[model samples]
Target: MPIIDKEGNFLAVADNVETISNSAAIADVMAQFANAEILGIIFPTHHDGRGYSLTKKLRRAGFNGKLRAIGPLIPDQFSDLIACGFDEIEISDEQFLRQPLVQWLAAKEISQHSYQNNNSTKTSIFQSRRQKIAANRHLNLVRELP
Candidate 1:
């Protein structure tokens, strides 16, 4: 899951900061990449060194997932965040969504993955058709009642 702050700004909090320092904590999160589907990570502040370390570890570990900085990051920190593997950032929903730079960062380089031919698609189509009929009938009943 994408890590977000209280206001929904993305952030990457070092999982093992108290037990270990930034370097060690970053190593740990990197190691778990195989088992996790981390969409993005967030850094709390520019002053916090942990997030930068974490981003470096993720890149070294082959994590191509999105990285973002949240909280009290300064304008100067933006370049550093990109250097540390942050692809996109959440400044404001409107600005983040509308900005061309943000759009470019958000765009993924498509890769080929294995696909399974499941017959579930046909079953789902039939189920949806049935639901539509039922919904129409219910709507008619409600309208007739008045």
Candidate 2:
């Protein structure tokens, strides 16, 4: 995932995302949401309350991924974000890397529930494809391990 700084410049691209300390223009940032390889957003401190509103809009606009609060975000705001559809969080670099595993587990759990619920045929098909990819990767890892 790549992080963009406040000036709309590329900051870093890695398997994980880190804190974005710079303030970005919310409109421009949200425009990147559809095409950005970014897995999350990190709202910096000292800006207007645009970041929270941006995240809420992103979720409403169909961003089905992580939405993180980087600087000056208190724990009390977690539930609010969750209510708005923010999934994973990145409190630190370590937490960011670990988030993929958490997401994988969550996906697996949700897939199970979805199978039981029998709703959203499209989602079931997508989840089956995702599970197949995961299983294939696991088999590759196991093959490489020994």
Against the reference, the lDDT scores of all candidates come to: 0.47, 0.47
TM-score of each: 0.39, 0.39
Off by over 4 Å in 1: 1-39, 92-146
What is the overall TM-score of model 1 with all chains considered together? Answer: 0.39
lDDT of 1 by residue, 15-68 (tens): 421112334455566565434433334444447778766666767777665454
Q: On residues 69-94, what C-alpha lDDT tens digit does candidate 2 reach at each position?
A: 55434334433444444444334445
Per-residue lDDT of 68 in model 2: 52
* Candidate 2 Cα RMSD after full superposition onto the native fold (Å): 13.6
- 146, model 2: CA deviation in Å? 72
* Model 2: CA > 4 A from native: 1-14, 18-27, 35-38, 46-48, 92-146
